[model samples]
Target: SPPTPPAPSEPEPPAPPAPAEPAEQGQPFAPSPAGSAADLGDAPSQFPNAVPPTQDFDDDPQGFEQPAPSRKSGLRARPVIALALVLALLAGLVGGVVGFVFANRVFTNNGVNPSVSLGSPPPPGSSARPADSVAGIAAKVLPTVVSLDVAGPSQSDTGSGFIIRSDGYILTNNHVIEAAASQGSITVGFNDGSKATATLVGRDPAYDLAVVKVDKKDLPTLALGNSDDIVVGDSVLAVGSPLGLTGTVTTGIVSALNRPVTTGDSSTQDTSFINAIQTDAAINPGNSGGPLVNSAGAAIGINSAIATLSQGSSGSGSIGVGFAIPINQARRTAEEIIQTGKSTKPVIGVTLDIRYTGPGAKIADNAINGAAPVTSGGAADKAGIKAGDIVLSVNGRTVNTADELIVAIRSYKPGDTVTLKVQRGGSTQDIKVTLASESTTK
Candidate 1:
């Protein structure tokens, strides 16, 4: 402004040389030392805390920027960290592998093979027992046991039987041949591999017993043992045709004796009998008619029935709860059927004092009240007795309970006469009557 601002210089001092070119793009240019005063129009506005080229680490400003790390130093430090991480990972992997190997070794030492095969059959001749060493008892009893095959119209059944005498007499379950009895066929297979046709002599369904005869006489037979001598827990064996696989042998201990069971005529609304021996030895449909033997292999009872899964499927296999008819009862019935063509159980002439009810049976006065001295068309009816009479004793044995009467009655057989002391309306009288056989035909 002093020398009268020379008329605006040409091109205005080249616009102050457009300020020196900025150091780089987006940077303000530095002041040029040779610039005239007027060329340095107002300096560019200063930015707050902006870094300066001449600033020293000691003290150019209260805060300053730190220099960036050198590329070489950063690269060297990176390798050391990477190596340490790699070593740690490698050590962890080695530890895991060592632990797995040690654990597997412990399991293998305890008979656990992680990679072994199982469930395959043992090689032939490597059985647990010697093949040639037959049970001494089995050898003795096998000859007496026979396989029975009976064919009916609707069913073909197989059972087991045993020769009871040298002269062709055989013992088996009555149901075994019952179907065959109706114009069917019965065959017997002996232990010697010989088979023969057999004739059904007679059968008693009430007792679940039957007698048959084979053409071959003088066959080897087993002697019957007394079933009364048996007790609970006695070791026993079962010989039978299980699943139609003939000559099956199973061993067990006697679970119980005198076990009463209700069996027979599932189709009929009313039919059953009691008295049995229970054993855990397996007995199935085909096992019926087999022999329950002792360790000595003597026939003690006849296998008769099994606790079935259901009534409709009686042909299924056993579940260990099997029943056998006591040999004593069977022996009695078989002998009678063979000789008389029928079997009979003892009975008292007087009507039962009461229908079996409650824990123990008791006498009902009306059971004999207004009734004829004897039942019409019965052994008691023929004895000339009147109804309304109570039975006080039988054969001089006091009969307080119906069970007592049954026990006393079973002591005698049909055609046997017994004296009964009767109490009629507060008075007692003596009467005698002969027992009769129960009709076998329905």
Candidate 2:
């Protein structure tokens, strides 16, 4: 009690509070400096477990202390980082230059882009044709084919032909050179790019054939084959200058035989009757007079006409139906023209009754013209073909009209025997007659 009286003399100014403990291990805290009461009044509280206002706390809930980086160490690291950045930039620059150079070398050729590649060519003779192949036959036949150009006073036309004699005797259609026969010119063009003026040796409008001669020797000629040997389905090639296309070659098969074809204008006497060899070859207007060859490259027919669906100046192209003059008849007519400058037509020596509209070709009962219905001592009269008789057939081929009978009779050469089925009043009889030759004139 006496010591108490000594009184808490100057209660040692509440010993400054201890510093707060760090929230985590290794964290340190600093205490505020001693100050007067007034000075410390505005200052943070110095109580234990309380933080000083001057001190900063970590944002982490569990306070973690990060060491302050040294200024000297930061200065030293700045140069190292700058050096690394500079090296990276230099490396990028060098890589870009190398890539540009490599790309240039790979895509450029003397500063020009390369052309498209098609690979190497095929080996020679890999597509060689046999001797009997179409190519081979064309090679052998093309040289013999000739193009005919005719120039008339009012018209000019072109056709095709083939060599028939080595002395430059060429065979063509009468219609081809007909315009030139009177007062025109005819020029023959060879496959070898050579040309010659041709003179008409002979022409037969009835047979639609002609022969032209050129002052040429050793000319290649085509071999004439027997048309009788060629039946239906036989392979044939038609060579001509179609549409003025020189050396044109087309192939097909024999479609029919003994087709009666009457061509030319009926108003004129130039009308021709032909026992045609029908084929599916592509024949056009310019193809007239060209050779229709067999598989052996032998001339079997002469391409003469094409059947068209329409007719006019606009004209028409091929529809695969073509007619050719049988080479047998052509041969006979050609021979006669060559030997005597004329040809002949076989006749039965009877005038047809054009008014008779019966089922068969009829003979006139009386003389319509000044001539007799049946010529005396001629083929028909000698064979007992009476006037007013109807010819039912010729050589086993049916004849329904006067034209059919004429065409059938003309199909045979003169002096050839033919059996004609004739219908009289009430009897039908087969009469054998030897055809007589009648000369044809221009």
Candidate 3:
């Protein structure tokens, strides 16, 4: 089991008061040249004659004056005004004819305007996207994707998940809901704006997967695809609530596959080893447990961790590199958790020497802890694997580190037989082993 998170610390004491400073002086205000009447009333009595008195222009000797026209002069101007009106009417008639002729030439059937009728409006439904298009996939997948708001004793978080079963079973990353696992709350927000309280069904920390259930039934679910069918450079879309932006989708290609990714605190059971499908899709803090779907809109992986340039509690954004748990593995773990309250992890029953700096993972010559280095009658022991044997590969895949070998084995279920390329002394040979199951309960 993972260790309980530490309690939040008390806040620091307030800083001491600063030394006193002299009071600030106000700046002098300058009055406008044309001051208001209120300003004149408030002015000092000694400045009563400051403004010059108003002068009347009616008796000014320099003013230019004109007399009104006489009645006989006005009668003479009327004939001239009538002749000017008659000329203006004839000019207006000529201008109207010219304007009409110009308009008739420009607006006729031979004009550019008539040649530019809107391109026959596209056939109805022509705007619809192809079924395999990104938009089409998003349209089909968004309703199945959901946002998770988890409130715990010390902190709160938001992540993403998707409906897996019509009866309200949801699949999400274990870490997304781990904070609220003990005496907290989980709220599921749907794309349709509906929300419901959820109860934890089960979780496997080893796989970093958890299943939760709501009270509702007949909910739409996303279709699951075979992760094994995924190849490099295949177009994929990551659908999730990244940074709490619900129903967000990003596009990318499968940059790599079968990447061994180990995360979480190694000292506790919270550690997760994944045979991850690497992608360049933007996966961020809140995108955990969201689906990485193919062009067909079928989910092939679960968006999990992201590679960042910085480390520690200070968060960072995606750097074009992201990893997702293969849906094949997630499907198995999810099915097991739904059936039972827990899931199992595949183990080879041999302790690896972590300190060995070699080409391949080397088994410890002796036990590191209290347990034996090799379990008697276990899969590794039964396959004739001895202590200090370096494992070069699982099946045909090369494993350079202990984590690589562990994740490669974890990709399979219990009782599956896999061939291991092991080197003992100066010789290397192939050994077949049937993997064993260990409960992930603790």
Candidate 4:
């Protein structure tokens, strides 16, 4: 006969936590830790780009009423108790490390090291490094960062911006004015508490950059720095009006550079943009157009987006995960926009398959061939490129995807010629096409 079925054991329920004491009315929420959410009766002026503090109730431990022990029970309680102790120890260690990292990344305001305790300094500070005195730098750079408010048709949006040219040229995220460009109004607010109307000069959605101009003269401007020189662990500062909170400053290190983040809504898979710099600085909703400056108070990147679980996500704001566009790219695009009233993106007149990964941008079709438009006897029609054509390479470099193709093509100017190797069905052929300026209406 089979062994007698073991007696049914009741399921173990989670231990209840100790009840928190009700706070006295009218008391302000204290900043406990980097991630703690203190109810100050209102949302933080800045997005609480911090983590919620872990509630350890051991100090007020309530006796857990464990299930009555049975002498005849097959299993002993010692093993379960030992396991709980081990798990608790592991959790404490992990939590401590996480808190330390978060404090270092998101809570260090005005360059005061959140990690250093009891007024202890790290070491003798260098002249060029950001010491515990970020107030001075903030004062110098705050005048350069501006708050951008846009009024769109369906909705209104706000973002941060920085003055780049003394003549009143401002730089901001292109998405801030995308709707406004279609139809709306744009304005800028300065750190000195002055608001002024602004005019949209030009915008480039491909790079998510926009240029705006104000009538004022002699505006303070931020010095542009080379983002290529940045390295992980380099101290940096983020200045912006997060969540409509104007002139907020946070400090952190350059988490990473040359980071790629997909931009654009998820619905349209056909179009997207990438390439960004990752920083642990606290960046939030209204921080989009703000400046990501280096220790020397120079603009290196433009704070654009934070990686979140979803859009309009609630709870702890910045998790030390933020991205920005390189200042070099923004500066070049802004100059072109200001001079020509638009960004002249260089384009190779070929339809490309961005998903192809073998060797080059596989040509699926050519929208423009020869000279005439698809309706007008276009040059593409005369060039003999048809549907089902795969572009193997451009010039000499292999184009594994459409993004690579775009990058290569953008490097060339309009009227310049480039050679493309194509795989027509099973056969390969070389074709030369003249690059075109994106500003062309056709």
Candidate 5:
């Protein structure tokens, strides 16, 4: 369903969910004359979305407050009566409790303790370390980042990419260069104003990853970090040319993990499922293929898509919902592509029932579209995964949809062992399935 077509004509990755807001005419995420960062580059490689909300969109609506349950989460709590209470208790040998209570009430007002001197305090603004902020990480990674200008025969687009190997090997979204892979020119522009022509080495549409190479051997490259180790709430910096703004930097936190995100419309969409790392980072047009680095300046994800309300003439902007392909998946795909002219995907050996509206991914009882419900002697078939079985999870990761099941399986490399939670015959069981290589399975 994916990665097999390395041709230039492969359809673009799923278009980010554009806001339903009616603009003038909805357009794909390409460098437009209306947005910022026009002069930086011409090829924009990112997604489209709506303007971000001024307030926290995910903030839970405050319910009606209950009496007597006030908390000063936003205030600084100063313990001013502690010393007085302790001193009173020590002074009184027997009625110390009575004396301490009297002192506490007199010194405290509405739980607002007076600011008491607690030895010498650090100077104002002494706690913040400049090196620990997003700017610090950006400074370390921006040099390794780059912008790509692709001039296709039919259309031109601007996108972003980053240095992965000092020998001029670059990593980026396959969608970024898909339109220009065969009939166009791709120019790699560095932060220092130097530009070089880059040629595609290999690409995998299944993972939306590609590797391109320049002539230089001394390009700055970013170190790939372990995506499996990243946690929610981790501070991150997204560096790229959002809307063609070169060297643009945005700060955000990991909003979710293992997010099952599939972009594209019903007509032309990649069959591969992307298990993305969700972030609130403002990824916009031309930010695709950019690096999502952590506090330590390690690249953990590639900014790929942004969720929008709908598409229109106003075009898609950032809605604070962005998805990044995990570095773990990207790294493996890129490496395989660099080594070989193509990449292999992991398959579970079953044709999922996409139309089934059931809770979990349902395997079709009958063959549909020439693909059998279960491949004979394939991984799933070997593990006794039948046609009616409903897959509930993968290695403890709950999967409620066929998209999720596919994404979860793809997260693991072929030849790796994984346990699938399946429902069969009114009972549930954990079946161990060793993933089969897409090439072998097919």
Candidate 6:
């Protein structure tokens, strides 16, 4: 069976958990584990560039639910008692010999261990050794990176993010802070072990992007690179906190691009869709919202989610198949978010037949969810889009499914006119549709 949006399974807990506030009225609430969904919202994920993607990846947010620490019994266990007995016997036999050796060596080393020696300092103008290698890039980039500790009403989640502006504007995945929106807070920790409280600047769930601001001066920021310039097999680095370990860095190459994915909690039936940049980096649950930096220490993509081993994800970490939101898409969304309280999603006024299961997205004969198949006097309708017309391509880019069409349109901004290749009545014709915001199109 084809996988739907990510909400896979609830855990068989070591013990029953305490109840918490409901996400919605009449809904029971419990914390979820990493890469799992709690709300059940679904979103379509886009691939990088114009490469057409084939499948939907229900990428779950990392560390969905962190279990409570285990409690200890009052009594000592047999294992501890047995180890203590063995240690007692060994101590009596070796204590005098150990003391004699330590006393003699402590003075013979001239008050400092002879093995310790000062090495030559790094060359001037290049404090980072091998300045062209991945280690060098990490040395420069890590200072701009941060580990986010988001506290929710019920649980706290860990994820990664990077500074985009020296004024301390940081970008991260929306899901990383979604739970914190209500009665919660986020603390940003830096590579230097210093931490600061952050406030939400803006968020757009449709794009799975969020911008948060910290009150700090002279902060280091990462340089943004053009995602369009990246190619397959390009060297990339994924830096973030995975499993609560901060400043973790992994290296890999671009595996594929323009992969269409829809990930979120299926129970909520709400999700995000996108065309993603695929890489084989060791991205684990806590790696979400981190930057995927190019060889030059520029951010090319925002590390988002990793695909699990459905009988095959390697371990609890990444399976070498991780997906990132292209920085090109993130750059646009971030600007709009910072400028406005929310970002707009581009949409063509047409209801697609998702069940058509054809080569290209097929327009439904009538509207679904009370939306008009062709919005009256709207972009598509005005551009001569008719019901039952099969859309073959958008601006010359092939769209294989309704999800693809949606993601492709979102790759652009509202008011951007794009050409569409439509097939109707056994004939193919080019049509132009100026996209409008989903908020206004209906």
Pick by lDDT: which candidate is best? 3
What would the TM-scores of all predictions be? 0.57, 0.73, 0.71, 0.56, 0.69, 0.69
Give me the overall lDDT of model 4.
Answer: 0.74
lDDT of 1 by residue, 115-233 (tens): 66778997777334332233666667778999999998888788999999888989998778888876788999988889999998888776678899998878999879888889989
What overall lDDT goes with each candidate model?
0.72, 0.86, 0.87, 0.74, 0.82, 0.82
Cα shift from native, residue 402, model 5 (Å): 0.7
The candidate that achieves the highest TM-score relative to the unseen native structure: 2
Which residue pairs overlap in candidate 1's backbone? 368-388, 369-388, 371-387, 372-386, 372-387, 373-385, 373-386, 373-387, 374-385
- The positional error of residue 40 in candidate 2, measured at the CA in angstroms, is 48
Error (Å) of candidate 1 at residue 306 is 1.6
Tens digits of lDDT, candidate 2, 140-215: 8999999999998888889999999999899999999888888899999999999999999888888788999999
Number of clashes in every candidate structure? 9, 0, 0, 16, 23, 31
lDDT of 5 by residue, 8-31 (tens): 886889988665443233343322
Evaluate candidate 6 by giving its C-alpha RMSD to the native, one decimal: 43.6
Off-target runs (Cα >4 Å) in candidate 5 are 1-129, 264-269, 311-315, 439-442
Q: For model 2, what is the alpha-carbon lDDT of residue 23? A: 33
Candidate 3 RMSD to the correct structure: 34.3
lDDT of 2: 0.86
TM-score for predicted model 2 compared with the true structure: 0.73
